[model samples]
Target: MDGIVVFGAGGRAGRAVTAEALRRGYGVTAVVRDPERYAELAAEGVSVVRGDVTDAGSVREVAGGAVGAVHAVSPFSGPEQGFASLDPDFFVKAADALLAGLASAGVRRLIAVGLFADLLGANGRPVMDDPAAFPPEIRPFALAHTAGLRRLREAGEGAVDWLMLTPGGGLEPDAPRTGRHRFGGERVPEGAPGLSYAELAVAVLDEIGTPSRHRTRVSVFVPREARVRRT
Candidate 1:
Protein backbone atom coordinates (compact mmCIF):
# COMPACT_ATOMS: atom_id res chain seq x y z
CA MET A 1 0.00 0.00 0.00
CA ASP A 2 1.28 3.45 -0.88
CA GLY A 3 -0.85 6.44 0.09
CA ILE A 4 -4.27 6.66 1.75
CA VAL A 5 -7.45 8.56 0.94
CA VAL A 6 -9.83 9.83 3.60
CA PHE A 7 -13.47 10.51 2.90
CA GLY A 8 -15.08 13.05 5.23
CA ALA A 9 -11.53 14.18 5.79
CA GLY A 10 -12.59 17.43 7.40
CA GLY A 11 -14.30 16.00 10.44
CA ARG A 12 -12.60 15.40 13.79
CA ALA A 13 -11.77 11.72 13.40
CA GLY A 14 -10.87 12.13 9.74
CA ARG A 15 -8.54 15.02 10.47
CA ALA A 16 -6.80 13.11 13.21
CA VAL A 17 -6.33 10.10 10.95
CA THR A 18 -4.96 12.26 8.15
CA ALA A 19 -2.48 14.06 10.41
CA GLU A 20 -1.34 10.84 12.04
CA ALA A 21 -0.80 9.15 8.68
CA LEU A 22 1.33 12.09 7.51
CA ARG A 23 3.35 11.96 10.72
CA ARG A 24 4.00 8.28 10.05
CA GLY A 25 5.27 9.24 6.56
CA TYR A 26 2.36 7.91 4.47
CA GLY A 27 1.07 10.10 1.69
CA VAL A 28 -2.59 11.11 2.22
CA THR A 29 -5.45 12.52 0.19
CA ALA A 30 -8.10 14.41 2.10
CA VAL A 31 -11.43 14.26 0.30
CA VAL A 32 -13.87 16.91 1.35
CA ARG A 33 -16.90 18.53 -0.21
CA ASP A 34 -15.53 21.94 0.74
CA PRO A 35 -11.84 22.29 0.04
CA GLU A 36 -11.60 25.71 1.65
CA ARG A 37 -12.86 24.43 4.97
CA TYR A 38 -9.98 21.94 5.19
CA ALA A 39 -7.27 24.02 3.56
CA GLU A 40 -5.05 23.32 6.52
CA LEU A 41 -4.69 19.70 5.46
CA ALA A 42 -3.34 20.77 2.10
CA ALA A 43 -0.91 23.09 3.88
CA GLU A 44 0.48 20.07 5.69
CA GLY A 45 1.63 18.46 2.40
CA VAL A 46 -1.42 16.24 2.06
CA SER A 47 -3.24 15.88 -1.22
CA VAL A 48 -6.47 17.80 -0.83
CA VAL A 49 -9.27 16.93 -3.23
CA ARG A 50 -12.84 18.04 -3.59
CA GLY A 51 -15.21 15.13 -3.21
CA ASP A 52 -18.38 14.02 -1.47
CA VAL A 53 -19.46 10.67 -0.13
CA THR A 54 -22.82 10.97 -1.88
CA ASP A 55 -21.23 11.41 -5.28
CA ALA A 56 -19.72 8.22 -6.61
CA GLY A 57 -17.96 9.77 -9.57
CA SER A 58 -16.14 12.34 -7.48
CA VAL A 59 -15.26 9.74 -4.86
CA ARG A 60 -13.80 7.41 -7.47
CA GLU A 61 -11.73 10.18 -8.96
CA VAL A 62 -10.14 11.15 -5.64
CA ALA A 63 -9.80 7.76 -3.97
CA GLY A 64 -8.41 5.82 -6.91
CA GLY A 65 -4.87 4.45 -6.71
CA ALA A 66 -4.75 4.77 -2.93
CA VAL A 67 -3.83 1.93 -0.61
CA GLY A 68 -7.09 2.30 1.34
CA ALA A 69 -9.71 4.81 2.35
CA VAL A 70 -11.37 5.67 5.64
CA HIS A 71 -15.02 6.69 5.68
CA ALA A 72 -14.88 9.23 8.52
CA VAL A 73 -17.26 11.83 7.14
CA SER A 74 -19.63 13.22 9.76
CA PRO A 75 -21.44 16.48 8.98
CA PHE A 76 -24.57 16.90 11.08
CA SER A 77 -24.74 17.94 14.72
CA GLY A 78 -27.31 16.73 17.19
CA PRO A 79 -28.82 18.71 20.04
CA GLU A 80 -26.28 20.45 22.29
CA GLN A 81 -26.05 17.31 24.33
CA GLY A 82 -24.49 15.26 21.50
CA PHE A 83 -23.34 15.68 17.90
CA ALA A 84 -25.40 12.89 16.44
CA SER A 85 -28.13 13.94 14.07
CA LEU A 86 -28.54 13.37 10.34
CA ASP A 87 -31.03 12.17 7.78
CA PRO A 88 -31.86 8.51 8.16
CA ASP A 89 -30.53 7.61 4.71
CA PHE A 90 -27.44 9.78 4.59
CA PHE A 91 -24.98 7.09 5.61
CA VAL A 92 -26.68 4.45 3.52
CA LYS A 93 -26.15 6.62 0.46
CA ALA A 94 -22.61 7.31 1.55
CA ALA A 95 -21.97 3.61 1.77
CA ASP A 96 -23.37 3.14 -1.70
CA ALA A 97 -21.09 5.82 -3.08
CA LEU A 98 -18.06 4.33 -1.36
CA LEU A 99 -18.79 0.92 -2.74
CA ALA A 100 -19.23 2.16 -6.28
CA GLY A 101 -16.23 4.44 -6.08
CA LEU A 102 -13.81 1.97 -4.57
CA ALA A 103 -14.83 -0.69 -7.03
CA SER A 104 -14.39 1.68 -9.91
CA ALA A 105 -11.14 3.05 -8.54
CA GLY A 106 -9.89 -0.47 -7.89
CA VAL A 107 -9.12 0.27 -4.27
CA ARG A 108 -9.33 -3.00 -2.43
CA ARG A 109 -9.53 -1.91 1.18
CA LEU A 110 -11.89 0.28 3.16
CA ILE A 111 -11.91 1.04 6.87
CA ALA A 112 -15.03 2.75 8.16
CA VAL A 113 -15.61 4.55 11.46
CA GLY A 114 -18.65 2.81 12.86
CA LEU A 115 -20.87 3.45 15.88
CA PHE A 116 -21.14 1.32 18.99
CA ALA A 117 -24.74 0.86 18.02
CA ASP A 118 -23.61 -1.85 15.63
CA LEU A 119 -21.30 -3.52 18.07
CA LEU A 120 -22.67 -6.46 19.99
CA GLY A 121 -23.62 -5.55 23.52
CA ALA A 122 -23.41 -7.84 26.53
CA ASN A 123 -26.62 -9.51 25.43
CA GLY A 124 -24.95 -10.65 22.18
CA ARG A 125 -27.09 -8.32 20.11
CA PRO A 126 -26.08 -5.12 18.41
CA VAL A 127 -26.81 -2.10 20.50
CA MET A 128 -28.82 -0.66 17.66
CA ASP A 129 -31.27 -3.54 18.00
CA ASP A 130 -31.51 -3.10 21.75
CA PRO A 131 -34.00 -0.54 22.93
CA ALA A 132 -32.76 2.08 25.38
CA ALA A 133 -29.22 1.71 24.07
CA PHE A 134 -28.92 5.47 23.59
CA PRO A 135 -30.91 8.56 24.32
CA PRO A 136 -33.44 9.88 21.82
CA GLU A 137 -31.09 12.66 20.71
CA ILE A 138 -28.58 10.18 19.29
CA ARG A 139 -31.09 7.77 17.82
CA PRO A 140 -30.96 9.25 14.34
CA PHE A 141 -27.21 8.95 13.91
CA ALA A 142 -27.20 5.61 15.62
CA LEU A 143 -29.76 4.31 13.17
CA ALA A 144 -27.84 5.85 10.30
CA HIS A 145 -24.69 4.06 11.38
CA THR A 146 -26.57 0.82 11.68
CA ALA A 147 -27.93 1.21 8.18
CA GLY A 148 -24.50 2.08 6.86
CA LEU A 149 -23.03 -1.10 8.33
CA ARG A 150 -25.73 -3.12 6.65
CA ARG A 151 -25.01 -1.44 3.35
CA LEU A 152 -21.32 -2.12 3.71
CA ARG A 153 -21.93 -5.77 4.41
CA GLU A 154 -24.16 -6.07 1.39
CA ALA A 155 -21.79 -4.21 -0.90
CA GLY A 156 -18.22 -4.96 0.22
CA GLU A 157 -17.83 -7.52 2.97
CA GLY A 158 -16.63 -10.12 0.48
CA ALA A 159 -16.10 -7.96 -2.56
CA VAL A 160 -13.52 -5.65 -1.04
CA ASP A 161 -11.54 -5.89 2.18
CA TRP A 162 -13.51 -3.83 4.69
CA LEU A 163 -13.32 -3.24 8.43
CA MET A 164 -15.54 -1.43 10.92
CA LEU A 165 -13.96 0.37 13.88
CA THR A 166 -16.22 1.44 16.71
CA PRO A 167 -15.22 3.60 19.67
CA GLY A 168 -16.68 1.50 22.42
CA GLY A 169 -20.12 3.08 21.90
CA GLY A 170 -18.97 6.69 22.55
CA LEU A 171 -16.07 9.00 23.39
CA GLU A 172 -15.16 11.96 25.55
CA PRO A 173 -15.02 15.25 23.69
CA ASP A 174 -11.96 17.57 23.80
CA ALA A 175 -9.93 14.92 25.54
CA PRO A 176 -6.21 14.72 24.86
CA ARG A 177 -5.07 12.20 22.23
CA THR A 178 -2.82 10.60 24.87
CA GLY A 179 -1.65 8.01 22.29
CA ARG A 180 -3.08 5.57 24.78
CA HIS A 181 -6.09 3.27 24.38
CA ARG A 182 -7.06 -0.36 24.10
CA PHE A 183 -9.10 -2.31 21.53
CA GLY A 184 -11.05 -5.56 21.52
CA GLY A 185 -13.42 -7.33 19.19
CA GLU A 186 -16.87 -6.28 20.43
CA ARG A 187 -16.90 -5.89 24.20
CA VAL A 188 -16.33 -2.75 26.22
CA PRO A 189 -12.74 -2.15 27.31
CA GLU A 190 -13.40 -2.93 30.99
CA GLY A 191 -14.98 0.38 32.13
CA ALA A 192 -15.78 3.97 31.13
CA PRO A 193 -15.76 2.82 27.47
CA GLY A 194 -14.39 6.16 26.28
CA LEU A 195 -11.44 6.41 23.87
CA SER A 196 -9.69 9.63 22.92
CA TYR A 197 -9.96 10.83 19.34
CA ALA A 198 -6.17 10.84 18.99
CA GLU A 199 -5.73 7.27 20.18
CA LEU A 200 -8.55 6.10 17.93
CA ALA A 201 -6.76 7.74 15.05
CA VAL A 202 -3.65 5.76 15.93
CA ALA A 203 -5.66 2.58 15.88
CA VAL A 204 -7.18 3.49 12.52
CA LEU A 205 -3.84 4.15 10.85
CA ASP A 206 -2.31 1.12 12.48
CA GLU A 207 -5.12 -1.09 11.17
CA ILE A 208 -4.78 0.25 7.63
CA GLY A 209 -1.21 -0.93 7.11
CA THR A 210 -1.32 -4.01 9.35
CA PRO A 211 -5.00 -5.04 8.67
CA SER A 212 -5.69 -7.04 11.81
CA ARG A 213 -9.38 -6.19 11.77
CA HIS A 214 -10.34 -6.67 8.17
CA ARG A 215 -13.90 -7.82 7.53
CA THR A 216 -14.68 -7.47 11.22
CA ARG A 217 -15.34 -4.96 13.98
CA VAL A 218 -12.60 -3.53 16.24
CA SER A 219 -13.51 -1.45 19.27
CA VAL A 220 -10.86 0.99 20.53
CA PHE A 221 -11.54 2.02 24.11
CA VAL A 222 -10.01 3.82 27.07
CA PRO A 223 -7.87 1.60 29.22
CA ARG A 224 -7.81 1.16 33.03
CA GLU A 225 -11.34 2.50 33.55
CA ALA A 226 -10.94 6.20 33.00
CA ARG A 227 -12.65 8.25 35.71
CA VAL A 228 -13.34 5.18 37.85
CA ARG A 229 -13.76 6.05 41.54
CA ARG A 230 -11.60 3.83 43.64
CA THR A 231 -13.35 1.88 46.37
Candidate 2:
Protein backbone atom coordinates (compact mmCIF):
# COMPACT_ATOMS: atom_id res chain seq x y z
CA MET A 1 0.00 0.00 0.00
CA ASP A 2 1.33 3.39 -1.02
CA GLY A 3 0.23 6.80 0.20
CA ILE A 4 -3.29 8.15 -0.08
CA VAL A 5 -5.20 9.31 -3.10
CA VAL A 6 -6.09 13.00 -3.07
CA PHE A 7 -9.41 13.57 -4.75
CA GLY A 8 -9.98 17.06 -6.13
CA ALA A 9 -6.28 17.75 -5.86
CA GLY A 10 -6.48 20.96 -7.85
CA GLY A 11 -8.63 22.95 -5.43
CA ARG A 12 -7.11 25.43 -2.98
CA ALA A 13 -7.20 23.24 0.11
CA GLY A 14 -6.83 20.10 -1.95
CA ARG A 15 -3.56 21.28 -3.47
CA ALA A 16 -2.20 22.18 -0.06
CA VAL A 17 -3.14 18.79 1.35
CA THR A 18 -1.51 17.03 -1.58
CA ALA A 19 1.66 19.09 -1.36
CA GLU A 20 2.00 18.61 2.38
CA ALA A 21 1.42 14.88 2.05
CA LEU A 22 4.10 14.70 -0.61
CA ARG A 23 6.48 16.72 1.56
CA ARG A 24 5.90 14.20 4.37
CA GLY A 25 7.17 11.36 2.12
CA TYR A 26 3.77 9.99 1.22
CA GLY A 27 3.18 8.71 -2.30
CA VAL A 28 0.42 10.86 -3.74
CA THR A 29 -2.02 10.24 -6.56
CA ALA A 30 -3.65 13.52 -7.49
CA VAL A 31 -7.12 12.97 -8.91
CA VAL A 32 -8.47 15.87 -10.90
CA ARG A 33 -10.75 16.57 -13.82
CA ASP A 34 -7.96 18.42 -15.55
CA PRO A 35 -4.81 16.48 -14.90
CA GLU A 36 -2.90 18.77 -17.21
CA ARG A 37 -3.82 21.77 -15.09
CA TYR A 38 -1.71 20.12 -12.40
CA ALA A 39 1.38 19.44 -14.47
CA GLU A 40 3.28 21.06 -11.66
CA LEU A 41 1.80 18.51 -9.26
CA ALA A 42 3.18 15.75 -11.45
CA ALA A 43 6.47 17.57 -11.59
CA GLU A 44 6.48 17.44 -7.82
CA GLY A 45 6.18 13.60 -7.78
CA VAL A 46 2.40 13.15 -7.71
CA SER A 47 0.79 10.63 -10.07
CA VAL A 48 -1.91 12.60 -11.81
CA VAL A 49 -5.12 10.89 -12.83
CA ARG A 50 -8.01 12.41 -14.72
CA GLY A 51 -11.47 11.21 -13.76
CA ASP A 52 -15.04 12.11 -13.01
CA VAL A 53 -15.94 11.90 -9.33
CA THR A 54 -19.43 10.68 -10.16
CA ASP A 55 -18.17 7.76 -12.16
CA ALA A 56 -17.25 4.63 -10.21
CA GLY A 57 -14.63 3.22 -12.57
CA SER A 58 -13.03 6.61 -12.85
CA VAL A 59 -12.77 6.79 -9.07
CA ARG A 60 -11.45 3.24 -8.53
CA GLU A 61 -8.72 3.70 -11.10
CA VAL A 62 -7.31 6.39 -8.81
CA ALA A 63 -8.14 5.02 -5.34
CA GLY A 64 -7.03 1.40 -5.68
CA GLY A 65 -4.21 -0.10 -3.61
CA ALA A 66 -4.06 2.65 -0.99
CA VAL A 67 -3.99 2.53 2.81
CA GLY A 68 -6.21 5.59 2.96
CA ALA A 69 -7.80 8.27 0.80
CA VAL A 70 -8.35 11.99 1.20
CA HIS A 71 -11.65 12.82 -0.45
CA ALA A 72 -11.41 16.51 -1.31
CA VAL A 73 -13.56 16.25 -4.40
CA SER A 74 -16.87 18.07 -4.88
CA PRO A 75 -19.16 18.71 -7.81
CA PHE A 76 -20.15 22.35 -7.87
CA SER A 77 -22.66 21.71 -10.64
CA GLY A 78 -25.61 19.35 -10.70
CA PRO A 79 -29.33 19.37 -11.40
CA GLU A 80 -32.33 18.76 -9.15
CA GLN A 81 -35.71 20.34 -8.56
CA GLY A 82 -37.18 22.42 -5.69
CA PHE A 83 -35.60 22.15 -2.21
CA ALA A 84 -33.92 19.10 -3.61
CA SER A 85 -32.10 21.68 -5.61
CA LEU A 86 -30.34 22.46 -2.36
CA ASP A 87 -29.72 18.78 -1.72
CA PRO A 88 -26.07 17.82 -1.53
CA ASP A 89 -26.74 14.79 -3.70
CA PHE A 90 -24.20 16.14 -6.10
CA PHE A 91 -21.61 15.50 -3.42
CA VAL A 92 -23.20 12.14 -2.62
CA LYS A 93 -23.36 11.24 -6.24
CA ALA A 94 -19.66 11.79 -6.44
CA ALA A 95 -18.76 10.27 -3.04
CA ASP A 96 -20.90 7.19 -3.45
CA ALA A 97 -19.35 6.64 -6.79
CA LEU A 98 -15.94 6.83 -5.19
CA LEU A 99 -16.86 4.71 -2.15
CA ALA A 100 -17.91 1.77 -4.27
CA GLY A 101 -14.62 1.96 -6.08
CA LEU A 102 -12.67 2.16 -2.84
CA ALA A 103 -14.48 -0.84 -1.41
CA SER A 104 -13.73 -2.95 -4.42
CA ALA A 105 -10.11 -1.89 -4.30
CA GLY A 106 -9.86 -2.60 -0.53
CA VAL A 107 -9.06 0.98 0.44
CA ARG A 108 -10.78 1.49 3.78
CA ARG A 109 -9.53 4.52 5.65
CA LEU A 110 -11.01 7.78 4.44
CA ILE A 111 -10.61 11.44 5.35
CA ALA A 112 -13.39 13.60 3.99
CA VAL A 113 -13.70 17.39 3.87
CA GLY A 114 -17.04 18.54 5.19
CA LEU A 115 -18.45 21.97 6.00
CA PHE A 116 -18.61 23.91 9.28
CA ALA A 117 -22.37 23.89 8.96
CA ASP A 118 -22.26 20.21 9.98
CA LEU A 119 -20.82 21.11 13.36
CA LEU A 120 -22.76 21.62 16.60
CA GLY A 121 -23.30 24.92 18.37
CA ALA A 122 -22.40 26.00 21.91
CA ASN A 123 -25.42 24.01 23.10
CA GLY A 124 -23.93 20.80 21.68
CA ARG A 125 -26.66 20.51 19.08
CA PRO A 126 -26.03 20.69 15.34
CA VAL A 127 -26.57 24.14 13.93
CA MET A 128 -28.70 22.67 11.16
CA ASP A 129 -31.05 21.29 13.78
CA ASP A 130 -32.58 24.74 13.87
CA PRO A 131 -33.93 26.03 10.60
CA ALA A 132 -33.57 29.58 11.85
CA ALA A 133 -29.94 29.18 12.81
CA PHE A 134 -28.49 30.24 9.45
CA PRO A 135 -29.37 33.15 7.20
CA PRO A 136 -31.52 32.68 4.09
CA GLU A 137 -28.64 33.39 1.76
CA ILE A 138 -26.60 30.56 3.27
CA ARG A 139 -29.26 28.03 4.17
CA PRO A 140 -29.17 26.27 0.84
CA PHE A 141 -25.43 25.61 1.01
CA ALA A 142 -25.68 24.68 4.67
CA LEU A 143 -28.48 22.25 3.99
CA ALA A 144 -26.42 20.84 1.17
CA HIS A 145 -23.63 20.20 3.66
CA THR A 146 -26.09 18.49 5.99
CA ALA A 147 -27.17 16.33 3.12
CA GLY A 148 -23.59 15.37 2.34
CA LEU A 149 -22.94 14.51 6.00
CA ARG A 150 -26.01 12.30 6.00
CA ARG A 151 -24.77 10.56 2.90
CA LEU A 152 -21.35 9.96 4.39
CA ARG A 153 -22.86 8.67 7.62
CA GLU A 154 -25.10 6.29 5.75
CA ALA A 155 -22.18 5.12 3.66
CA GLY A 156 -20.22 4.27 6.79
CA GLU A 157 -23.00 2.06 8.25
CA GLY A 158 -20.50 0.42 10.58
CA ALA A 159 -18.70 -1.11 7.62
CA VAL A 160 -16.20 1.56 6.67
CA ASP A 161 -13.84 3.66 8.78
CA TRP A 162 -13.91 7.35 8.00
CA LEU A 163 -13.51 10.86 9.35
CA MET A 164 -15.03 14.16 8.31
CA LEU A 165 -12.80 17.20 8.88
CA THR A 166 -15.17 20.11 9.32
CA PRO A 167 -13.81 23.61 9.12
CA GLY A 168 -15.00 26.37 11.51
CA GLY A 169 -17.44 29.03 10.32
CA GLY A 170 -14.71 31.54 9.59
CA LEU A 171 -12.27 29.32 7.71
CA GLU A 172 -10.64 30.83 4.65
CA PRO A 173 -7.76 30.22 2.24
CA ASP A 174 -5.63 33.05 3.61
CA ALA A 175 -2.54 32.87 5.77
CA PRO A 176 0.38 30.43 5.84
CA ARG A 177 0.96 27.20 7.67
CA THR A 178 2.00 27.94 11.26
CA GLY A 179 1.57 24.27 12.22
CA ARG A 180 -0.47 25.53 15.21
CA HIS A 181 -3.76 23.73 15.94
CA ARG A 182 -6.31 22.35 18.36
CA PHE A 183 -8.68 19.41 17.94
CA GLY A 184 -12.38 19.20 18.72
CA GLY A 185 -14.29 15.94 18.81
CA GLU A 186 -17.59 16.33 17.03
CA ARG A 187 -18.59 19.87 17.84
CA VAL A 188 -15.74 22.33 18.12
CA PRO A 189 -16.99 25.57 19.62
CA GLU A 190 -18.41 28.04 17.15
CA GLY A 191 -16.82 31.52 16.62
CA ALA A 192 -13.41 30.17 17.55
CA PRO A 193 -10.45 31.31 15.51
CA GLY A 194 -10.94 29.32 12.33
CA LEU A 195 -8.29 27.51 10.28
CA SER A 196 -6.46 28.61 7.17
CA TYR A 197 -6.21 26.24 4.24
CA ALA A 198 -2.47 25.91 4.67
CA GLU A 199 -2.73 25.02 8.34
CA LEU A 200 -5.59 22.64 7.60
CA ALA A 201 -3.33 20.91 5.08
CA VAL A 202 -0.65 20.49 7.70
CA ALA A 203 -3.14 18.99 10.13
CA VAL A 204 -4.51 16.55 7.57
CA LEU A 205 -1.06 15.28 6.67
CA ASP A 206 -0.24 14.80 10.37
CA GLU A 207 -3.50 12.95 10.98
CA ILE A 208 -3.02 10.60 8.00
CA GLY A 209 -0.07 8.66 9.44
CA THR A 210 -1.76 8.45 12.85
CA PRO A 211 -5.16 6.90 12.40
CA SER A 212 -5.92 7.04 16.11
CA ARG A 213 -8.36 9.78 15.17
CA HIS A 214 -10.26 7.41 12.90
CA ARG A 215 -13.99 7.71 12.29
CA THR A 216 -14.13 11.09 14.00
CA ARG A 217 -14.97 14.58 12.86
CA VAL A 218 -12.08 16.84 13.81
CA SER A 219 -12.66 20.60 13.83
CA VAL A 220 -9.75 22.98 13.24
CA PHE A 221 -8.89 26.35 14.84
CA VAL A 222 -6.06 28.85 15.11
CA PRO A 223 -5.13 30.34 18.44
CA ARG A 224 -6.47 33.87 18.84
CA GLU A 225 -4.10 36.77 18.02
CA ALA A 226 -2.49 34.99 15.07
CA ARG A 227 -4.93 36.72 12.74
CA VAL A 228 -7.43 39.56 12.67
CA ARG A 229 -11.06 39.01 13.65
CA ARG A 230 -14.26 40.72 12.63
CA THR A 231 -17.68 41.11 14.22
- State the local distance difference test value for candidate 2: 0.72
Per-candidate TM-scores read 0.85, 0.81
2-47 per-residue lDDT for model 1 (tens digits): 8999987788788889888888888999988878877778889888
Candidate 1: regions farther than 4 A off: 80-85, 123-133, 173-180, 225-231
Task: Itemize residue pairs with steric clashes in candidate 2.
Answer: none
Q: Show where candidate 2 strays beyond 4 Å.
A: 77-87, 123-135, 156-159, 188-190, 225-231
lDDT measured at residue 128 in model 1 versus the true structure, 0 to 100: 66
The CA lDDT of each predicted structure is 0.77, 0.72
